[model samples]
Target: VIGVKRRVHGGLRFTIPVSPFDRIRALKQECDRLVAQAPPDLPVLFEQVLRFERMIAASGVDSVPSHADGLASNILIGPDGRIELVDFDGAGNVDPYYEIGILINEVFEDEKDFLPALEMFEGTPRPASLRRARLYAIADDLAWGLWGLVMDATSQRKDVEFYRYGFWRFIRCRAALERVDFGSYARML
Candidate 1:
C-alpha cells in the first residue's frame, strides 16, 4: 500500500455502478425464532473469520489496524475536504486487511461489482489482500444472513422483505463459499 498523504478536498468514498435492485437500504425484524433456526453455515463462517484474522495479523503488513465495522455512513468528508473516519465504538487492533475487506464488501455488495472496484482502487490488486477480502466478505455475508433471519423473526416490523433479505444473503454466502478456495487462503494463517 502506498503511503497516502492526506490532502484536503475531504472525500467520502462513494461506490460507483451499484444497481438499485440489490441495495439493502435499511437494516432497519425477529430475534429469538431466527436465532434458534439460524443455519449451521453461519457458525462455520465465524470460525473461518477467526482463522482469517489470525493469518492476516501474521502476514506482516504494517497495519493501520482494523475497524471491524467500516460502514459507509461511519466515514465522512470534513468541511476542509479531508477524509475522516469516525465512530470508533468497537474498533480493535486487527489485521489491516479486515477493514478494507469490510469496506470493499459493503461498497460492492454484489460479487459482480467487486473486481472492477478492487482493480481500480488497488491499481493492480495484491493477491494476499484480495484473497483476504474474499474471506471477510464471505464471513460478512453469513453473518448478515443470520442476523436478518433473527431480526425477521424477532422484530415487530412486519415487512416480508426481512425474510427475503435473509434468504438472499444466505444464497450469496453459499455461492461465495463455493467460489473461493478457502483452504488455500487458510495456509496464510
Candidate 2:
C-alpha cells in the first residue's frame, strides 16, 4: 500500500498538525536563539539534535496522531482511574515513540523505571525503541528549554520563573546526552 490512514477519536484536536520534520526544524531555529545562561554544551546539544533528526528521517517510521505535548500538566486522572487529556495546542501527527518518549520522561523521574514502564507500554520491551524514546526525551528537553528561555525573555509575567525552568530542562538534557550509553543508543538507532 502506498499510504494508510487511521481514524482517531473525535475529541482529539489536531488543528495544528505538524510533521516530525517541522518539529526538528523548529528545534534548530530555537538553538540559534541567544541565551546568556545557556548550557555550556550548547554546541554539542545542537549537533545531537541534528543527528537525531537524521536518524528519524532514516527510520521510515509512520507518524501517528499524537498529543505532542503529553506533559504531566496536561493529564488528569480521576479517582476511578479514568484518564483525561487536555491542552491540544501542540497536537499533531508524529512518530509514535515521540508520544511514548514524552510520557516515559515525565512519568518516570528515575532512569531505572524507564525500561519497565516502556515494557508496560509495548507489552514487551524493545531496546531499540527505548533508545529512541530516550533520544526523544532529550530532544523534548532541548525544545522546552529553549521555549522557556524565549518566554522568559519576552513574557511580562513575573509569576513564573521561566528562565530557571528553561535552564533546568537544559541541565536535564545535558545529563542524558552525556550518559555513557548515549552513543550506544544513537548507534542502535
Candidate 3:
C-alpha cells in the first residue's frame, strides 16, 4: 500500500472586531425592521419581544466574545470530521447564554433534550441558564420568523419559500410560548 499523508486545517476564527453595544443596537434595529414589515396580528411575537428586551436590560450575565448568529448553515463539518464556523459579520461580545440558546435551538428538535443539551455545553447544567436559553430560543424564533416574512415580501427570489419558513418559525415560537412551562421560565427569571 502506498503511504498517504493527511493534513487538518486549523480552526478558523469566526469573529471580526465589533463593539458590543454597537452590535446590540444593530441587532435591535434589524429586529425592529423585521417586526415593522411583519403582519401585525402576532400578539405572541410582540409579547416575546417585550420579554426578551426586558431580559436583556436586566440580565446580570456579562457579555463575552461569541458568534451572534447561530444558524446551522453557518456551521460546516469537514469530511475529516472537523468542524468550522463561518459568518462573523454579526460576531461580538454578547451574552454567552444567548449564543448557547441559539445553538441549542438550532441543534435540538425535542424540548425534552434542552436541559441535557445545556449540560453538554456547561458540563453541569444550571436551571437559571436553562431558563435563559429557553427564553432566548423563543425570541430567536420570533425574530427569524419575522425575518422570513420580510424576506418573502422584499426578496426578488420567488423560488425560495420565505413565507413558509417564517410561518414555521412563528408556529414553533408560538407553541413554545403557549406551553405551561413558558410562564415558569419567565417567573424564574
Candidate 4:
C-alpha cells in the first residue's frame, strides 16, 4: 500500500474518503436486520453472542492483531471465487470479532442465513475462524454504537435513527453476553 502527502501552501495535506464511514453505516443496517431475525433458540444465539463479545473485547484489548474490516467490498475476488482483502485502514490492533460481525451482517444481508457462516467458523481457534467473525459482529456493534452517538452529538439528525439502532444492537449484544455459555469462550479471555 502507498501513503501520500500533499503540499498545501507550504504545509502538509492529508485526505480521507467518506466511503469507509458510509460503508460502516451500511454494515450496521445490515447487522440490525439480521439480528432482528436471529433464531429463537436463545442458547445457540447466546453462545454465538458470547463468543463474539469475547473476541471483540480481546481485540480492543490488543490480544490479537488482524484485519478488522471484512466486508464484501473489501474483498477482491479472482477466478473460481478466490478472494483477497483489499483494505486495511481499519485493521490495526483490532479483534477478530469485529470482522466476524461484519461478515455475519453481510452474509445475512445477502443470503438471509447466518448458520452457514457460523458453521464455517466453528471449532476454530479464538479470533481465527468463526469465533473471530462472531466477535467482529459485537465489536462492530460497539464501534458503530459510538459512531452513532458521535453523529447524534454533532447534530447529524439524519443519523440519529441509525445511532438508536446501534444502541439497540449494543443492548442485544449485552443480552447475548448474559445468555452465553461462558465455558466456551472463557479460555480465550
For lDDT, the strongest prediction is 2
Tens digit of per-residue lDDT, candidate 2, span 1-189: 001112332235455555544565575566456455666776777777667777766766766677666578887778997666778777776776777777778788888898887776667978788888887888888777877877776779979999888889888888888773646655776
> Tens digits of per-residue lDDT for model 3 on 83-163?
777786777656667777777888889878888877866679888888888777877877777677777767899999988
Q: Please report the TM-score between candidate 3 and the true structure.
A: 0.76
Which lDDT values do the candidates have, in the order given? 0.55, 0.71, 0.66, 0.46
Q: Write the per-residue lDDT of candidate 1 for residues 43-69, one digit (tens) a residue.
A: 565455455556655665443333346
**Residue 26 local lDDT, model 1:** 22
Clashes per candidate (backbone, < 3 Å): 12, 0, 0, 10
Shift of residue 114 alpha carbon in model 2, Å: 1.0
Q: Rank the candidates by lDDT, best first.
A: 2, 3, 1, 4
Better of 1 and 3 by TM-score: 3
lDDT at position 10, candidate 4: 21
In angstroms, the error of model 4 at 126 is 9.3
RMSD (Cα, Å) of candidate 3?
Answer: 6.9
* TM-score on alpha carbons, each prediction: 0.59, 0.83, 0.76, 0.44
lDDT score, candidate 4? 0.46
Instruction: For residues 57-173, write the lDDT of model 4, one tens digit per residue.
Output: 554443234444555687666897665666767644333334445667654653225456555544333333444444445545454654554554445468347557647656655
